[model samples]
Target: MKVAMIGAGYVGLVSGACFSEFGHQVVCVDVDERKIRMLEQGEIPIFEPGLEKLVADNVAAGRLSFTRDLTGAVADAEAVFIAVGTPSRRGGGEADLSYVYQAARDIAGATEGEKVVVTKSTVPVGTGAEVRRILAETNPGATFHVVSNPEFLREGAAIEDFMRPNRVVCGVESKHAEQVMRELYRPLFLNETPMVFTSLESSEMIKYAANCFLATKITFINEVADLCERVGADVQAVARGIGLDRRIGNLFLHPGPGFGGSCFPKDIRALAATAESAGAPLRIVETVNDINESRKKAMAAKIIDAMGGDVAGKTIAVLGVTFKPNTDDMRESPSLDIVPALQQAGATVRATDPEGVREAKELLTDVVWCEDAYTAMEGADAVAILTEWNHFRALDKGRMKKLLKQPLMIDLRNIYPVDEMEKAGFRYVSVGRRAVGN
Candidate 1:
């Protein structure tokens, strides 16, 4: 199988590499020449666990390649995948599908013979129809079958998710496209991965629905964490109790600042807007979006309150700044909200992340970026663990106490036990746990 992956961004790079690893020849096409150059030079532009090795192994085996020549890549490929970004529209929740549409037009011009054009980007319900329309309008005589095949890869664990996905969903109306898809994912058949075949619209809906539902679960738990705090209850125990139920199963039940990433924030808003446009609004999803935003914003104030209400002349140490661990992605991260708010309260933020410093340096400004968590903790009034990175999971309590100006700690991710911190003789604050342990 020969695959031309359009857009060598996160999705395209990972998917193309994985497909090539499955013994298929893959050429990742990107409009960005620098990105192509980087890939060719074996300098992975993004930080994903095992992705660098996977791409390198496949490229060494002559199974994977990268190019900015879209036409050359698309013309020789049997399956052309559109994996471009569809960001939320400005001042509106609708997805701006201009990139997806432009890719469709480009694919239409470059496609030779009968080609299966699969959309690997997360898009709206009627997007495939529009893509089909674009293909026909752009090249009236061309034969193109547009298939909606949205990706379900998690950021930090994208490679694992791609290689060992629970299921593969494809929106294929034509037999030829279905056959091509089946052959493309033939490697997964060995593992008996469920292949969901649905209509184009259903496939598109599935992606949004899945993301929004997970976002809802996060929001629900966050709200419960708030309630647990007010009612003198421990949210960790609460989460564990409910997570044992088969229905809940506890994935996104961890209470934190809020949900922020490439997918959740935009996907939920886009779904809400799409549903409203279709004359059936999703109130729960809409509320989830609103609540998550508020949750992220509220975390800064919580930190300030934990630090004795006035951080006007204080220096606060932020342990992690990325959205999650194992990835350097800073898009919509809770630190974006909390850091700025803390600065507004006249506090100096000393932050450190094992992998996020490079990207965070670009998004965050005027903060004192440090080499490590201990460096950030040095001379700070209080320390806050915003993202639960593994490095922050275990630290010397006595060393932390010695480094910090005071023994004040805020564990937003609930990474520490209240009793242990209390016994350690430090003033500890955590989410939905006992208040201000000493």
Candidate 2:
């Protein structure tokens, strides 16, 4: 199968490379000349695990390629996937679909006979319908099938997720579109990955609903962590107990500074706005969004309180500034709020992440960036673990204690056990558990 991916950003690049790996000849198109040049030079712009290898392997096999020539790419393919970004509109939750619409128009003009247009980007419902309308209006009497095939790949584990997805969703109104999609993902058929067929609107809604629900779960657990602190209970124990129940299973139940990533915050706001427009506002989701935002700032207060209610003239080491581990994405990371809040409260911040510093440096200001975790902690008053990066999970407690001016630790991700910290003879403050080693 021949596929043309419109937009060589994260979704398009990954999906295009994976499709090529599946024996499909894929051409990834992008308007950004610099990005396309980078891809062609074997320099990936994003920091997704194993993505560079995947792209390199496929390109070497002559199954995948990148280009800025949208017309040429689209004209040569049977399927055109719009994998552009639909970021939140300025000061609102409605998705900014300018890029998507532009792609539709370009694809409409460039597409050859019988092309299946798939929306692999996260979009609001009715977006596919609008794309279809734009395609028809752009090129009259063109045989194009627009599909809503929202991607569900996690950043750090995108390749694995794509190769072995829990399920593949396709929104098709016609048998032709359905068959084309099925053939494109025919490899998944061997793995027995469930194929969900639904309406365009349903497919779009599934992406938003899934992310919002996960955000809610994270927010719910964070609130529970607070309550556990007040009532002298352990949130970890409570979570474990509830997670054992089949109905409640234990993902996204771990408490932290809050959920802050590319998907959760954007999707929650978008869904909330969509619901409000439809006269069916989601109060719970709205509250979760509000709480999660406040929660990030509140984590700075927790650090202050750990320093005996004053962060003035204090130096705090923040390990892991990325939203999560194994990626350089700093979009809406909690550290964006927490670091600045700490600075506002007169605390000097020293932060480091394995892969996030390059991107984080652009968003975060007035903070000392370090090369590694230990370097960040050197001479700091206290150490705070923001993102649970793998190396931070088993850091040298003795070395951290020696490097810090005081033996104080705030484990926001609760990666450390309370009893172990107590045994280590260091003051440890963690979420959903009693402070140990006073």
lDDT at residue 174 of model 2 (Cα atoms): 92
Could you tell me which residue pairs clash in candidate 2? none
List, residue by residue over 30-116, the lDDT tens digit for candidate 1. 989889999999999999999999999999999999999999999999999999999999999999999999999999999766889
In model 1, which residue pairs have backbone atoms overlapping below 3 Å?
none
Candidate 2 residue-wise lDDT, 1-438, digit = tens: 999999998889999999999999999999999999999999999999999999999999999999999999999899999999989999898889999999999999986567789999999888999999999899876788989999998989999999999999999989999999999999999999999999999999999998999888999999999999999999999999999999989988999999777889999999999999999999999999999999998998998899899998999999999999888989999999899989989999999899999888889999999988899999999999999999888888889888999899999999989999988888999998999866
Model 1 lowest lDDT segment of ten: 429-438
Candidate 1 residues lying further than 4 Å off, grouped into runs, are none
Whole-model lDDT, candidate 2?
0.93
RMSD of each: 0.9, 0.9
